[model samples]
Target: MTDTTAGTPAATDGGDPPDGSDFGVGEEGSDDPRIEFRGGKWASTLPLVFFIAWAIFQSGVLGIGDTNGLVVGALVGTTLGMFLVRGDWKAYADTIFEGMTQRVAATAIVAWLWAGMFAQTLQAGGFVEGLIFAADALNVGASTFPAAAFILCGLLATGIGTGYGATVAFVTLVFPAGVLIGANPVLLFAAILSGAVFGDNLAPVSDTTIVSAVTQDADIGGVVASRFKYAIAAAVPAFAAYLIAGSAMAGVSLEGAVALRESANALGLVHLLSMGVVIVTAVVGRHIVEAISWGLVVAVASNLLFGLSSASDIVAFTVTEAGALSGLPVVEVGETAGVGGSLYTGAVGFFPLIVLTLLIVAMAQIMIRGGGFEAIQTFLLDRVATTVRRAELTMVLGTATINGMITINTAAEIAIAPYVARIGEKFNINGYRRANILDANTSALGYIFPWAGGVLVGYQVMVGPDGLGSQYGPEMVVNPIEVVPYVFHGWFLVAIFIIAAITGFGREYIPDRASEEVSRA
Candidate 1:
């Protein structure tokens, strides 16, 4: 393996040096004989095109709506890509397998698994019940609650670095409380989603943030700082929007609303400490996997010590005789260990998504080796991306467009990152600026668009056919489609960056100063 990042250069403050030596290249790697695509750049990109098209058909149009289906599509799509290779058949096979097992993809997959377990454990431990108790104790008016919720949920998402987790948390806990206290259903759900957008764009620990930084060669701290202005530019208006909407909307109570207020428990608040552990550890520079693991440990302990659920129940997985895995191990078809605890379900729920991501990486590697990556870079630099302002705008809109089209925002980000890096470097755009452009829009549009993963994640928590609404009471649920028009922050953030790109409010060039060390992120 050759160190493509071979001669390390010292980084400085202000902006990145105008070092064009590494321009127009993908990640650091030595020349591998099998990597060269026999097909032209266009041919090399066929696999990626097929994969994205398949995702659109499955998740965007036909609405299969299950990630595993997309996983199967990617799996088949990548194997088909092998036919385009011009070299040894064995080399092509090896690259596909190698990409499916890449560190970058695996790292992200592991993080998701851990985060899932942590979120589920918190739920089982009555984290929502604790929040409800606090909400009732605080005596916030039902109408004013949506405005307050926007602020609180934003804080939690920013601290924890997972907007999906925040959306799930607020949907389960505060949402029910709001319904009980007479808040408008659609308006309240919008507020919860707005908070998710706020944190996902600006939080250092966010997966999108990490992806944006590493891919663009920016420090995490600098990336967060550079984007804060854009976030605030959009946030102020969004906050006011929530307040106005909350005031105009009326809260209506449901059957369980009263029961919820009466049954709020204070002991479940211990999970707040679990959340804090994750925040502190992540902020102190620990690996996300390690930080989330610590949080998971603490949450399980809180569940047992606080008596939220039994130890066995917390770790349960059901083995039903008629279930999908009828003949598999302890999961017999007839008898249903109750092994499917929040921890178990949460962790496993992301399995399909993880597999899909790995396959996407395999597709990306195909594009890179096949010269498709280089071809796109050439087009951007020689044509549309002419000026610094135009380049930055292209980065912003490009990210937004891709994220909007792809149901999964992370995959969209990965697909476009190489182009962002190559184009930004052409005009000497700072890594921080590139990262901000990549992430802010990636986070915003994911929730704003109808087909996006973020919006679906929240919807699944609320009124999806299998959602808790059936179990907890249908009256408290809000329709996902109805909530789209009210998602102020996501739309506002997109507008802010578009405006910023044109007006040069937040854009920076490498010549402006030295670049910060990217490793710090």
Candidate 2:
């Protein structure tokens, strides 16, 4: 979810100096060292550029939503970029390790793993079935399901402090149920993504929040406090839009809708307490790992104690034939079986995404080391960002552009952070303002694009062998492309920032107020 240590020097992940000094921008009158590229600074962008083209071709053109395929693309792109180095291949190779080891990459991977497990455990406990029972009892039909889903998913993401985790949890547990209830599949999926955007932008403990504050040298509390206006300004309209669109959109007609609702049991709702445990613990400043572990323990206990799910259902080890372990509750002999259960499937589901993240970050590291970032910053500062208004606009557009290119929002934020700081400080912009601008675009664009991490993560839960399609039929699956235009909150947030840039809405200068010292939350 969130890392309290994100602001501290120890959180560098090998990117920054040991003393926590910023990268990308060198000190006054000093030139930052850069790896020479054969074709100059622009050539350093080949890896990311190649990966983006590959992503657009695969996910957008061919309509193949495969995370592993994207991983291959990133790998190939990174390797291709290597041959273009002028000399010293070792430095370029080392940058890959440097990028992969960054705290930003590790933080995202850790969240995905833990969130995956927690979501699967809740699913094992019939959390979706419980929601269906509640919906049926309260008369929440297809016309209202999307709106309700948006609100609920937003709340969960806000509590957990990780939009990726919320996306996984809701897509695993909520998406199918919404489709089964006859909600428009594409719209429902978009609603989930929109909710993620809201939480990712507004949540105090969100990774983007931490990164934005720390990178801008501002207090986390002040950054969160100042951005509330912009978040709510976008959220209110987004919620209304969901309600309006939910009614206008045509839901899928499902033959089993009534039957599924009838079979749903309220007992499954006990998992709410399990989810609450995670939210409360994380909100109270507990480590996200600890919070999710507590949630897992509660979910498993609830499943067994309330008879929602059996021990074997939660985690089972299977063999070809009967064995000594077969006597155990979690062990079995079956025709086709192996180690399979919530824990295994949940954690394994994110493996492709994890690899892709590492590769992309490695590519970003190469760009950073080879002067791609510095070159871009110099051009913007010299040619485009001369005035204060232009500087803020440059920051907004620049952040959006980087996020558009990178799938992982936090990594994108980290890569663009130094530029945001330098550009904003050049004009004496408030640290809070800079952090907000840096994070809003990072949070919004990360979920809006078809190949974005938030969108891909949710898409992965829909089409796999163990996904919603297998459980509720193929009609329940929502393609990532179809949901692109409907992530209302993300689009709205970005638009709000663009307008804020032009109209000076909520704009603050450094002279308006000085930010407190950055500290670990």
Candidate 3:
């Protein structure tokens, strides 16, 4: 879940000066060599503009939430932008390669792959059955399921430090359990995403958290500490909203709900220890990849040892002719040939998202190298952000706008980071305050939008061939668009920051205090 890429430079300075001297100033509008475009710097926005339009049309107007379709949109947008480049076409081509190879994109890709495999492994070990058993034993009716799910999912996400991982795990496991117990599917999905938003905003190890702190020259620990107030401010209301909505909303009456409860096995709850292993490892500062690997191993071993699943169930090779591998537990003869398993299916589910992320980053790079960001920064500083309040508001709104366009929140945070730093330093804002403003909007908007990475990852789990919809019924599949309005935590977080920006609720000037040296937590 913590996707901080290797080789990210830590901030060396302690904090920006309160005098608003030369420190962190002119970083945004300074003259620098950039790729020229046919219609001035404004033309650099063509790729991102086209991609955003396609995303809105595909996800909003047409109601198709397919990540692959968005991939096509990005592909077409990037291809079209090449025609507008003024200089050598090779420079544009190289920029595409550069964007695709960025550490931010790679970090997200690696986290998704590892998180996917770990989540599927847990499902294979009967984690969903375990939750169903717990729900039934505790007499948790549909009226309170969303609230309970929100808390549990939030805890897991906070511990693991990856909202994407939490979304994948909860949607794959806890979502079906909530549905079987008669919770409204859309509400439950929204609650899960809300929990992810909470963790992504507050988790010290989160990539967005790292980026926000590093860009603002604040310590990661202090950033996490300072943002706790904002996170809780949003979470309290979100939890209450879920409770109220859970009661008002009705759940689908499934034919076998009673039978599923009756047949639930408590032994499956043993996987809780497997989940605990990952959480503990991650919280202890081990790499997320290592933590998930340990958890996957424990899950697979538990499934085999406890008779929860078979080796073939966890992984299997299907061959038209088994040949020499016929005797192996994972090999079998079938009408078709392919590799199938928790690991394979889990990793394969995110293939489209991986490609989309790369393409989107490429588009963002096009905007960056073509001086599109500089143009926006100049406009905001020169025309709009004249006061401290307006500067803070611009940072909040600007971060939200960019995150809305870029599905990857971390990448969006990276794109808008310099502008945020420049704007905050112009007013001598404290680094922690600036980081909070930067990360809160980045974390919230990423999960709320239909085309967002967090929402799409969870949706992929629901709609896959062997997904929850296939296992249960079509009602189990919550459309990405349907859950948008219900992500109370995301909306609440953004609202809290906007109000804070206007009212100076948590604003701190650099004269109030200087932050400690920045370091990776």
Candidate 4:
């Protein structure tokens, strides 16, 4: 009922999600030049180093807050990186192109494209509005609001598959309501982010999940199921924390919330059926792209049949003056046209991100070739990661270290995934353990950090024109910094993974045991 659901397709089918846990590579003895890095390890590392430095400066220092801006910076930086390629620029260029086109990056990109379309159509169908109605009917007060909000947002994030979307929705819609009913602003923001952490970590359709599974050479179904226990464990304490915080911080405010109940349509709740199809398909071991595409079809059909939106709105690819048209050929000499509606806008929203993912993968490939990955591997294996326990801890610490530097988690996941695969394999660590380490930090840090993609998106909604600040005033806006201390779920998830590594809670090894998989197709 928190009214968020302009979302990612959160998870695939869960045979029920628990405790968690590649890069693809070829034979070690092979001398294939294609697998080789042309430059020395130090030289190969320059591009990755450059990108990290640019990231630290851009998001951490300059505070530009533009995702696309980071992409541009990556482009320029990587091109400069090519200068360090010792031999022919042709081979270097080819390596970059090959990395850009590889199947791992392609799989996640395709899934995202379908997810965007499905999420948009679902939003058009009033899924979130129904949630708002649910909230109003419950009539939650300050003491119960934060906890309730966390649960609702968690469900919505699971259904939608996007923590960022959930954060924006909750921050925009539920935050004001919580504030009006007297929940602390910091606690409210943390509740929103914690819900995001739950969804992003558990959602099968999530990019982080897809990236973790594909990069580590494991199936998505196995990844989600194996990771369930850790998610629930962290969530239990997080839920209790929200409960206590909600009560302790309770106060009275005279200003009432803007009513969202009037806007919800009962028919919109039927989209839950569409969400079911996605989950069942995913849980049954279907391909993520196929699973989400079917969900998108259901969303479109539901929108029209339920009268949530019109056919024109579904494909309103109209040429108009207000929006600019660059790529489409529909423009005349003086006429400019643009697209609207569910399908186009939905899919298009992810284009930049998909490209950025590809470029980062390309950079990662360069690092692997140049022995940069091996160099880091040697350092960890020799000095820090001397034992299984130490190796696991190193994995956790290493993942956390990279995530802390990078702003967008999905990109950071891609960047660090190869190292996780290589290092974990050295200890014969299970794919699930490696992945859990890779993903837990990747998902957790993004929500906790002030400049993180998830947090920034939520904050943007809060301060935007129609946001809480505009509706109420500046006092209602939750600063990114203020909310960090209260981000209980993110912090707990990280701690759980670290403790899991040290204590051997949910660790497993491949070949010794196969992961739990979907039994039916």
Q: lDDT of all predictions, in order shown?
A: 0.72, 0.86, 0.86, 0.70
Q: Per-prediction TM-score, please?
A: 0.80, 0.94, 0.93, 0.74
Residue 293 displacement in candidate 2 (angstroms): 1.1
Can you write out model 1's per-residue Cα lDDT over 1-521, one digit (the tens) per residue?
A: 74223354455554553321122123422233345555566777777677668766765566455566767777777777777777676766776776666655665567667776787778778776787787778877777888888887888778778787677667766676676777798888888888988988887888778788877877778788888998998989998988888889886657666677677889878888888898788777777778878998898877877778776546644554465655443343335445666777677666666666677767766776666756766777788889887888888888888787655666667667877887888877778888888888898877775456676666556544335677567666665556777888888988988888899787777655444666533
**Listing every candidate in turn, what is its Cα RMSD in Å to the true structure after a full C-alpha superposition?**
6.8, 5.5, 5.9, 9.2
Encode model 2's per-residue lDDT on 1-521: one tens digit a residue. 64222333323233332112332222311336457898988898999999999999999888888999999999999999999998789988988997787777888898899999899989998999998888888998888888898888888888888999999999999887888887899999999998998888877778888888887878778998999999898888888998899999998877677788787989989999998999899888777888889999999999999998889887998888897778999998898878888998899999999999999888888887888888898999999999988999999999999998899998888888889988999998988999999988999999988889999999899876598878778788777888888999988888999899999999988766666767554
Ranking by TM-score: 2, 3, 1, 4
Better of 2 and 4 by lDDT: 2
Clashes of each: 20, 0, 0, 21
Question: C-alpha displacement of 391 in model 3, angstroms?
Answer: 0.7
For 332-391, candidate 4 gives per-residue lDDT tens digits of 222545556667756776666667667776776676666666677678878998888888
TM-score of structure candidate 3: 0.93
